[model samples]
Target: MQTAQRNSLRLLQWMMVASLALPLGLFVFASAVSWVSIRETADREIEHSLDVAHEHALKVFETIDRSLSEMAEIIRDVPDADIVAREQMLHLRLKRLVTSLPQVKSAWIFDAKGHALVNSLVVPAPEIDFSDRDYFKAHVDADIGTYIGEALTPRPPYQGAPFFGVSRRRPSEDGSFAGVLQASVFPEYFESYYARIGREPGSYFALGRADGTVLARFPIIDRDIRLDRNGPIAKLVAANPMAGLITVTSPTDGIERRLGYRRLAEYPIYVGAGLETSAIRARWLSTMSQHLIFGAPATALLFALLGLALRRTRHLHFEAERRQQAEEALKHGQRLEALGRLTGGVAHDFNNLLTVIRASVDLLRRPDLAEARRLRYIDAISDTVTRAAKLTGQLLAFARRQALKPEVFDVSRSVQMLSEMISTLVGPRIEIVILGSEEPCFVNADASQFETAIINIAVNARDAMEGRGRLTMAVGMAASLPNAAPLPQHPYGYVAVSVADTGSGIPPDQLERIFEPFFTTKQAGHGTGLGLSQVFGFAKQSGGEVAVASEVGKGSIFTLYLPRTAGSGRSRQPATDAAAIDGSGTSVLVVEDNAEVGRFTTDALAELGYAAKLVGNATHALEELATGAERFDAVFTDVVMPGMSGIELAQEIRRLHPELPVVLTSGYSHVLSEHGSHGFELLQKPYSIEQLSRVLHRIARRDVGQEAASASS
Candidate 1:
């Protein structure tokens, strides 16, 4: 009896200890998790602010570049004497230009001797010699393209805020440096824009030269501050010149911050945004304190109710699982948000293009328009249409719905041929290295799309490396993919084309989403974010897959795996410029649900010398065909309709009229993308009149050939 009592007492003591520790441990773990989440949130906010600063900086510099280009054009042919004679008139023009751009403080044209010829700041410009100025000196000897000078206050009597000079060297007719066209860009303009966007306290923005000279900054400082050449931020920029994120202490203020920075593509400028580490830590501390306030009481209550501790622990586990589920739901919502952004971006671009087209059309309708003006309007419309088509094509490529013409080609040869072109595209700073296996790796895919994919990947690598890095393109064969299922044609193996870059790698959070449409790490206006997505889609649509492996601060490698095919592979024949054949005396049956489209189709066919009959829907089309009142040479129908889809209609027509040819058309069709055109010729929407005429003519000619063969038999 004594032994049993001792054992029971020990058991109760141990149970009590576990009960107290369990809740305390859970509280600590939850607090740590909360702290991490808060830090990540702060980091993302800082990164977004950096994106805004980058975009603003690019716009500011681009406007300056445009203004300089205009000035250069204005004086391209004029002699120095003419410029002196037209000084007053040019001064007014320059003033107007500067006034239109809020960021530009003034404009000046300096002759080769550094004498001010014309300036926006004063009429009958003062005979000020700017030979001592850094911008003038920099361009006096060499043509360094565009030179963006450090911040400097204007000569005493005429100043508001310090400004930087963005100048381009003007060339003489003999290709020698003739003068400099300079624009004074106000740093306060950028500072004001930054202040508006960065409303959070302890946040800062800086615009600096690649060589560490500060051009503009928010939280304005009185003294000039230049970054140390060997400092953490400068080293980071040297290592990864395009863009990156870092956590460091600010040398000027001694405050630790999490900073994100991007370097401009065409200029020696860098934009950075950072959040004070103290502020982030304070937020984390506040959140943890609230959790502790709530958790402490609950922990004590559990300790008091030791008998029910086991049940309470189980409930806490259930809550944790529920929280995980909620987090997953939040991730789904984020994906939806991304999709919304993609749609909005697409809509915005299309709206702008449409606006241009509408204005051009309105102008063309004017009765008093000159021939030159009319031709310009027509050309504008044509260019807009072409751009619109390219946009839609990119979208289709991302969706994996583009109509591709597949052919068997040697991947190794293609890479070899593209190496020179890639070198040219990426510039001299990037070294292009090609590695190919002795054995030819053949694959069946679209030749043009394959080339495009390679170029896109190379361009992406260039940006990631900031135009200076080694890009290795390797072609070989692989038996299996890294994270993909075995291909249906596994017996033949796969052609693996890998592109490796020594550049800043993608972050862990962004690695999985690199292929998402409209997702990019590049600064705005420098990328459309469709390149990798296009690569992804083209690979998948070609019965292959694209895989990426990246390590932050190291580099990245993107590999495209295509199913291998036997044979040496045939060379792609050059496309001939075929003329549209006349469609005289041929009859076409047009099946379209939309009234306006049907009318347009009939009119276009009539203009092309084809007799066409239009019907509202597939059912009516079938009825008209059943009547046999009018013999049809060919059937042209849309793929998508209200009832009995065009694909189904085509199938029915083929079943009844075994001798007739059918052509299908659509801007986009899920059926066509997924199941193909059911062995019929397909014409894409927005096709030219010549294309329409040719397709109809081909079918009519085929029908005639068939009839003649039957008669001869």
Candidate 2:
């Protein structure tokens, strides 16, 4: 009995020790798990913050670039002080760029000699030399790109606050480096948004240059962070990867931080967002405190169950996160692949066109080149540029982002005009036949985009036909058709432009997906598969829709339904301008900034039997006209120039000489976008010789008729 009792006591003591140990083990395990969870959450949060910071930086950088680009282009136009001093519109625009964006400190134009010629904030001050500035040095050597520089100490009387600058190089009319257009942004601008960006108390954020110089940092603890010469950030940025993570000790403070950083694709700037590991540990401790209050023995069972549950939950959470990451990566891969394919196809076409242009240009350089061959080479380059433009314009329309300058135009006439080009696109084997309505089929939409859709459809049909079949293009008003697609409200009527092909048709299952972007039935390198999608987007964007009827064996018919406006008999397309009127002996004033463009305009006009006098800018043009030395029938000017935009110049001409027709031309003009054509004729840039001649002839003839009619009355 004594032996049995002694053995039982010993066993009981051992059991007691194990009971206490179970709860202790559970607590330790819980603490470890909570720490891991907190760390994971912190990592995710900082990563998201990093992306936001990156986007913010990119947006700011882009705005800077865009502003500088416009400024640089304008700076090339004006050569004298009177033009810059007397220009209110230019001053207002520059001031607006600075004042509109809260982050922008100043916008200024610096001459090649690094003298501040014009400023957004103040009147152009004399002798403000920035020759020693880092931003200036970057642009002094390179003619392309906007450069982000290290922080700059405030220039005298400006205060002690430091600022960083972003600058773009401006080239002269002859393509020689002229100056730099720059903007300064204060670090405090970013600091103001730190609360929002780094929401967590112990979180950190920073903006750095590509040279690994950290410009701004949150916690305001570290203002100057000149990174190690060849550290991880330097190496990572040099590699040019978009995003990555790094753990480094803060140079400003001794604290260790886990940071996520992202780089801007176009700019040499990076944004980093991070949190201290101590932050995570603090949160983990807080969480453990809540479950640590229970009695050790009672908590033993609860801890056992909780541990299993927590482990399982974490496993599932990890799996969910992994799956999500995998899906995102796959999506990113697909997008990159599509972009690669698209770029590859575009590059091939551009290369072919450029090759022709290069060869023609080279041939032209020869002193003894024949006149006939010279003209042919010039025409070839022009034609190739047009082809390249059409290709890119189609892509832009498909993106649905190109600004639409809607005009009332006849669809039938446009189709008629495009027939010759369609033939060229479809090749000699394919026969293109146009079927038009006797009545006018008019739509209010962008005419070039409308024609592009037609071209894309015809090209698609030609491919379906294997380049040898009949392609019929038909256009008519909805009421005239026996059966047409329903019209969208708002437009008075609708017009159907049908492109039918006698070729192998699409499969029933593939028809629905054919309009999806990058979904090509053709083999690789053959098609971008954007044709149908372009047609669809154009129609929809024009307040219209696209429909199709297909059969496996029979050829398919694709119809584009566009919103129509009030109209009557089929109108003649203005391809040769007014075929009856020619610009013979008509003196035109050509006001252009770029020397090459001015030369081309003069040569093209001279070639077409018109008298052309070229001047550098509006001031010179005005002075020439003011002298009354020679009579000018019309004025053709570029819309966006330094001292005054073409629209403003045209206004001045109209005020001084209303009878003299003023023609405006632009590739893209903010003046045109804001104020519109304003009753003057507009010729889009990259215009052909024929287009220029036709426009000039039309305006001159119109002006002559008006004068004649007035005199007779």
Candidate 3:
């Protein structure tokens, strides 16, 4: 028994030792992997910085080379005598050239004797001798084509900042060096550009000659510094002259860096971009410290848990199961609570609308109601019903199921037209600025809904600003969304309408919930909170999206992005003369699922001088049409119904009748929202009598015109 006990004790000790060793090994391996990843990411960042610097250098050099070539061509045929004689004219030309190029400071034409023939700085060429200048001397003996000389300070008469000369050897007829045409390029130009591109802390950009002559360095050193020919960078260049990566200490600053260097393809110049090794290492260390901070504790906790688990496996399992059950119960309760809030909000708004309608109807029912009072009550009821419809429409919009009549229209022009209305809506205290591209940006969407969305956003902006601030609405083109996701099938790209305001701005926590229905930050009665929700839903339903950005103290900007349409199709302007829309007793087939609505529609149609017949569904309507009992001018149908939807029915009627016009009407149809009106006129639900009459009359007139044309043909 003693021998067996001893062996078991030894086995337990070995197991514990193995467990500890395994975790330690894993921690070390993970640390190694993280280090490698961090280094690689740092290297990639450095390389990217190098690429930006290289491209900027190329652009600057190309511009300079082109300018030099143009100047060379202008003076190519002119003799030295003419160049001296027409000094003022040549100087003016050079001045114009320099003025055009922001990078080039000045231009100078030197004779073979190194006398300044013409200078852009002064009309009569300055009595300055360029014989001593490096650029002039470089071109004196040999035709070096184009020479980029080292940086030089301006001499006495010619005064400005330190600038490097880019010169071309002016050849004589015998192929001998005649003179030099030099353009003074300010080092500050390249340095300023370098400052913009290399923005990382401890980052550096250097423009240098192939022979270690430093022309410019960003972070502008107090004194000029050149690279040593025997340095690591020079050795790296000697090995790979075109481009390379180097890890070395700066001879000037003595700070070590990981650098990426590139040589210009044509020019004998190099552009180097680097981040201090300390920064890179610090980044790596910071990342590693984070891993250590989390991983060490986690590993330690895992070890403690594993040890405890070995001792009480069954107990731990029971505890885990209990915790999981508790979590699930908590989540379920939260979901139910959220559902209650949503349903409660919707019910409250609808009940308020119903109460107004009920009170209006009761007042209208008074036995001795005054004519004005009765009209006022009736108008109140109408307005209440419209509000109710709008509330439901907003809900449907949030659900992305609102039926929309999409048409191609210019977003810029729409904003411009609505600027006056927006100004009034926001109030006098708020300054409204309308900005848009000179070129029209077209988008395919419901124009009315688009206007509503803008107004909704503007109202929110007005409230956020407390009615005093600047509200700017800008429309422009965007290639992709903020998330960098590519658009689909829209070769014309996307149109972005951004509404910005100087307001109190939204909290980060509230931003995520801003689009949720009835989620408002305002006090009671201040807002419905469905404004942004409507904008969100409308954007999504239109194959677009809305995004917002905000800071607590700064303001907020809401941008709606819609697919751009290449066609320049503007929204049809409302007919100014009502007489143009003539019904003229045109026969119509009305397809409605509701009995009351169908009866009301038919009566309204007849009252508007259109002979009408009603059917309960598309099947009955189609059957009636198939019978050919009467020639119908158009088919007005509801979109959503039991069996054979209005859109499908319209397609069927179009196929069979070919000449009949189909007008679709809907309150909210998922099909209609997802797929548009299918080339049919659409009348949204809750439309007024005037709106209904106008639609029917327009279709009727169109049909009559088509019939007349057919008969004539």
Task: Flag regions of model 1 displaced more than 4 Å.
Answer: 1-321, 416-424, 427-433, 465-470, 485-489, 502-509, 550-555, 576-579, 701-713
Number of the predicted model whose lDDT against the real structure is largest: 1
| Residue 255 displacement in candidate 2 (angstroms) | 67
**Model 3: runs farther than 4 Å from truth?**
1-327, 438-440, 484-491, 571-584, 701-713
**What C-alpha lDDT values do all the predictions have?**
0.86, 0.79, 0.85
What's the TM-score of each model vs. the native?
Answer: 0.52, 0.44, 0.54
| Model 1 pairs in collision | none
**Candidate 1 accuracy as lDDT:** 0.86
Model 2 segments beyond 4 Å from truth?
1-331, 364-379, 399-442, 445-452, 467-488, 491-493, 500-502, 507-534, 548-555, 577-589, 603-633, 640-660, 668-676, 700-706, 709-713
Q: Which candidate's TM-score is highest?
A: 3
lDDT tens readout by residue for model 2, 1-713: 99999999998898788777867788889888888888888888988888788788888888878888788667666764743575466666788778768788888777778887777766645466788998888877667587888888878756646889888877667766677788998888887676666768788988887677888888885447788758755775556467777776775678888888887887777788998978877888778887786646456688899999999999999999999999999999988987886787677767878999999999999999899999999999888888776666556556664446678888888888899989998999988889998876778887867887888888889888998889988887664323443532543567989999998999988998887666789987687777787887787667677889988767999988877776443454554333323567788999999999999999888877788999989999999889873488889999878897788889998898877888889876645554568989998767877778877877874557767899999
Which lDDT value does model 1 have at 151?
Answer: 90
Rank candidates by TM-score, best first. Answer: 3, 1, 2
**lDDT score of residue 625 within candidate 1:** 87
RMSD in angstroms, all models?
A: 29.1, 18.6, 17.4
Candidate 1 local lDDT, 1-713, one digit each (tens): 98999999998898778767966797789878987898889889988888778887888788889889999999996888899899999998998899789899999998888988899988777777788888888987778989999898888568687888999888578878788899988888988998898788788899999889988788888889899999876787788789888888888878888888888888988899988888888888888777667675665686778858778889999999999999999999997898897997688778889999999999999999999999999999888987788778778888899877678988888898889889999999998889998987888888988998999999999988999999999998898766766435556788999999999999999998888877887777677777888898898888888999999878899999988976677876545757666778688999988898889988988887888999989999899889893488898999899989999999998899877788899988878877888888898887766788888877764557867899999
Clashing pairs in 2: none
